[model samples]
Target: MKKLTLPATVPVKELAERLSVSGPELIKYLMGNGVMASLNQSVDFDTAALAADHFGFEAESEEAVAEAAPASTRRRHPLLDQSRADPKSLVARPPVVTVLGHVDHGKTSLLDAIRETAVASGEAGGITQKIGAYQVEKSGRKITFIDTPGHEAFTAMRARGADVTDIAVLVVAADDGVMPQTEEAIQHVRSAEVPIIVALNKIDKDGANPDRILQQLADRGLVSSDYGGDVTVVRTSAKTGEGVTDLLDMILLTADAEVEPKADPKVGAVGTVIESHRDPGRGPVATVLVQNGTLRVGDYIVAGQVYGRIRALLDERGERMQQAAPSTPAVVTGLSGVAEAGDVFQVMANERSARSLAEERGFAAKQQQAQPVRRITLADLASQVAEGSVKSLNVIVKAEANGSLEALRGQIEKIEDPNVKVVIVASGVGPVGEADVNLAAVTDSIVIGFNVRPDDRAKAAADTQGVDVRYYDVIYQIADDIAKAIKGLYEPTFVDVFQGRAEVRQVFTVDGRPAIAGSHVIDGRIPRNSICTVLRDGKQIARSRVAVLKRFKDDVREVARGYDCGITLEDFGDFAVGDVLEAYTVEQQNL
Candidate 1:
């Protein structure tokens, strides 16, 4: 038998020809596996493997095809090629700092205060929203600030292996003390191995206690230098601009005392995508922060799968610039599409080289999508727990309204399992869709929808990608489900709640045994095999299990309220005309 050559995905007809089988036969084989593919329809590796086994042929993924080719054919991204740089040309660059904290903790306000101070000092670039980034001048030096929404965006950018930031400024509200998101931000900063400069904000508010905030920081492993630790804590109020200058001074001092932010500005520009969006006038715009070299006008850059020339370079002031140096944030126009946030951007030799690299990486990404995915299930949580792989249960929540989503998020995050942390990857209002499933798959998170339903496409993708999609009408139910999952062994118990009462009109004998009681359902429907209690004038006579419930001569599952039906109970013989039959059902609720 000849070995079948498969490119990540292969058409049914093409595989059939390689296997010497008829196309219809291959399609029938695929149909047995639940993949209804036509002759020309492409099948992923799983489908291809099954077809190849049935037809006595060998199939390999596209990665094997690349391995069979010459080593020179495989292209490495230029940004990863460290040998291309010259150590002699390296120079000190501004430290790229990310301000992370809980929402409304003065993260944006501190950035604004720094920008205003820099602008007052005759800095060329004013604050620009295009890149969500800016640079502030301090002591004849520059410190770049990436104004992300929160710590999640900061971690998401780092998750893509784009280590762009040199330091993290952790902002904490003095009045609020240490919040849940504050701890999360601290973890992200520590995980990234970036030094943190604590910015204690909101000191102007009533009941503000900087000392209390410092004590809380001690509990989280962040001791202040005043307390005989290396961490620097600067108390600042962004609203009044008090101690804001001191905060900037501390950032510069920390950068010098700790790690020196240096880059080779003599080489081609290499950086990361801070933010990206589509503009009405421009085709695709990206807010890129150049980490190394100098990005100039007309430079061809490839960011992840998107490649384009620098049609225009706009500084943080929204004014056109000729070039941007290391740690400089610039809005570049003319990308083929909006590159993903956190995608690494590099300047190639020419447009053709950039295009070729993008195409190569794009193809490789598609091939990775074709590989088999091991779907994580509730049962697998045990194995993950044993392997210590499940330290946290990451969740993406979708809801019908912002208020409900926030409520659900707040309650779910409170599900405390010291062994397993619960992290909310993303949350929004609306029906759960494919985008949510994609994010969950990428982050190894589960999609949780509260008072919302997943569309058919999202459901299918979740199943295919092995992402768990759970729907709940009540907020507490979702919380309980996740709590049980993290605990790994907590089984729930249920109690039977009475549904309704019915009166027996008459009784009939079947095969010489007390069989059916002809009754009228007084309230609520009576379900089949539900527990019933025989009562005589509000006094309990006996309790029996419902054997069968029938409406008329037909065997029906349920008898609705205000309807006549026959009910049969096991191990019960006595029947009375005035007897009442009460029905109840048991439902399991997680504790």
Candidate 2:
């Protein structure tokens, strides 16, 4: 047999094209071995190796594969090549900070007060919905603020092993004290191991008590700086803008307390995506904070599973820019797709090589996806527990009704342990189908059906595929079974709640009863039936439902890619243009 030559870099879609298959088919191949990927996703050498094996080919080392390719195809970006310069050679960079707290805590207001911008007036519910990063110069020093979702999105990012935060601005309403979200913010900040700057907001409220807020902070081990503690507590009212400058000054001082990392402008680029979205005009756009190297126009870049040559670069203010360096957040255009938020982005070499490598990777991915996935059995579970291969017990749950499905999924996530993750893949109110079975089979995951039964074909398929399909009527048994399986992994489940945020784009009047709005699909996919808050300008105008979806008026379901579509809201009618809509979903884990 002739030896097959595999390229080091492969574009996933191209590989699918080469095989005359779809991207999802290739994804299924890799997923068969517990590796989850989307059609546009890129796979590395190891993943490609696995794919090659499944395709009956000899796997080559990534380095070896790269050498076999043309030199032009293996070129490296200048920015990435200089990632390790001395700290003294680095330029002063802005401190990336996250503003977090409970609802109505004036988190957005404080940011508005700092930026001197009217962002607060554009958000829904008066709470910051998306993770926005912007820089402001205070007393000749630059400070970057990352407005994280006050809800579950922050936790979701952490759950993905990507902690894209530096400092945390914990905004606690003086009257509200330490509310649920406040504590959650504290936990998230602590989990990221970042420094905290407590902003006692809403002090202008009649019930405001900064002293009580400080006491609450002390209870949470966040002692104030005035009281001889490391954490800085600034009292500021977003309404009156009182003590806001002092807060900025303190932020600069705190930033000075930390050592800065050096940036090698001559080396390869390394950065983090503060935010990313697919714009109709610009394609894949990412607001990237160049951390270690300089980024320039025409640079080929790899961000998460996507790669493309930079077509244009714009600053946070929407101004065109030629280059951006450490700590500067620039919106870069031209990517294979919108990279996931919090994904690390690296500048690559030429576009041809980038595309080639991307294609090879895609081919390898397809091979892996076509392979049969191993199912998780009791024996395999025991071994996985012993070997810690099962850090989380994943489940694809389906139920007879929406309400029961939601409740059961929620309850299952509440099982609590830090080591196990209870993931509900595709949950709907319907009979368990082949799609569910296929997902479970490929993920080595379990299928839990509540008051719902799989069809004979699905059951037979599950059996033939060696998948475990567990039926449950009682919610507790379902929870218990998952809990036991997690225990078998020896790592207790940690029920950490995660939040995701999306922006509303355009609103359409559905039958004139309630309005369905088009939203810029932000951070995560807008799960069907998740509660949504609609904001006109910056204030939350109403709460609504994603009643029905018509993609380009075709009457289909589920919209991604920040695409504009006609959607019907349940029992609501007030929607306007330029109003931000935030849809959030909460995820619970066992810990």
Candidate 3:
């Protein structure tokens, strides 16, 4: 059988040709699998794999193939300790931890209690900490706690390839058995492969059932050791100082038993930027967690594309420090610009080499893989509503995670309108597929996607059927949009529709004119005067409007695949050979 290597998404016509079959025949096969797609419409990897199998072909995704590479030859993350450094120089370091749980649960309260107890127990004068992380000493051993907005930020940093948390302290309220956010946190921590130590909070409250909470944790696969499981459970209350020290001890014990984090302090400092901002007095300030080596004042450091010599180093207590050891988080000032959260920070030899390396990284990452999540704020969707404008507003909710699904549905139902009512026609998890669009078309409902995009089949179906689909990353936007729509203040949302993709095979430069990329339409059709993005090595390099397009010396509106053409971008001049251009058109969608 023939073997095919497929990207995350593939156009139907292109896949049909690769399968040595007609386009209609492939469409028939897709219909048999309940996937509706036109010849030019793209399909995800799973769908394409099934089609390839029907024709006696083996298909594998690019990601799977990369993961199958030999471990010896594959490059490792530069920040990891196992990547380099001599074994003789390695020394034991404290484990960094993050507290996560439901919103009402005492995650912040637990952190505050630890800090307060730390000061009251034996520590000398303590200053109010403003840095994103802090360390507390127990029995002469220090434990770092990263202050973040629960598992959302924790999971986000991990997604960027920074495993900052060595242990996850899951704070579960005794009163509430297990909420949606608690379950979500558990899934995220488990996926990160971090050891979880349950902090059963609110045991001091009336009718706070610790047994019920322990049973709920077991149901979620985090069984306590008392129940014959390996998970460590600690009972504590932020209201009173009960079991707070035990929680800290549990962190230390878990660290020693599971994660023996060590690093060579003699080498240059390497850390992860937890937070950064433009401080009016201090300039660009960054809160970094030192994972290896020792970061000292006057050390040249590079965090992502920004690099500068550290002028000052301060701990989480806001006290000046000469150096920060492994597992110690410090606030540093003197970076050229504000480093992004989760960016790897490395101490370099000198200023010149650091600047050169930073410049090279900046050019390569002209646009980093840091694709911003589509965040639609409340102010963007907020509008005054007119009474009796909408009798009923229908919607179909879809998300990438199930934990947020029920909460989103409940938030939508809670929106009170004087005359109109909100109705959820259908709700599900995963990407929006053809079946979702079909349901929306028949029910007169708009599809709402949270932190997920629609598949090619769904996009094509929605476009053809005139069904509106709105996507948002944060839940606040979805709730606000629904509230506004029900109040008769419905505002239209604009989305990008995939047009086609082109690959630059060659470059032609004429005298006294701009250079044109000799490109071939690899899939679908590239229309003239459309928005285009230049992608090199799977990373977006530039995005601009199509200024000029031609085919064989003649101005044409669109050039389809299997045809060669010349194209020029409006504002982009740097076009390398092998660069792929993805074309798109703006579409306005409304409730």
Writing each residue's lDDT as its tens digit, candidate 3 over 141-251 gives: 888889887675775565454668889999999988788678767756765667899999999999899998999899877889999999999999998979999998889
Local lDDT at 536 for model 3? 97
What does each candidate score in C-alpha RMSD? Answer: 13.8, 20.1, 19.0
Please give, for residues 1-591, the per-residue lDDT of candidate 2 as tens digits. 112233565656644433323455567787888877665667776776567566444445545645555432112222222222345556666677778888787887787787673232232234322337667777766777766665345544443334455577888888889874576567545545567888888888898788888888897789987778878888888888898888888777777786342355555567777678888987888877777668888888776667888888775556678887777777888899877776666665556545654565556657866775544554456467667776666677778887997899789879886776766554556787665665555445677888888898788777666677777789997777667667774233333232334565666654646666665665555555655676666777777666766777587645565566565668666667666655554432321
lDDT of each: 0.78, 0.65, 0.78
lDDT of 1: 0.78
Model 1 per-residue lDDT at 168: 91
Compute the lDDT of residue 24 as modeled in candidate 1. Answer: 59
RMSD of 3: 19.0
TM-score winner, 1 or 3 = 3
Q: List pairs with backbone clashes in candidate 3.
A: none
- Each prediction's TM-score versus the true structure: 0.55, 0.51, 0.56
Candidate 1 steric clashes: 0
Of candidates 3 and 2, the better by TM-score: 3
Off by over 4 Å in 3: 1-76, 83-85, 119-125, 367-591
lDDT of 2: 0.65
- Candidate 1 lDDT over 1-591, as tens digits, reads 224456678777556544444455677778888898876479887778778877665566657755765533112223432322355767888988889998878888878777777652376344445468877787789888888887767765665657677789999999988886787677557656679999999899998999999999997789999899889999999999998899888888888889787777776788889889898988798998898779999998888889989999987778899999998989999889889998988886677667766775676578768886566655466457656778877888888997998899899878897788888866777898765676665567777888899889888877677787777888987887777778775354568788888999998887997767899999987888898999998998888888988878888888888999999898786878979999988754322
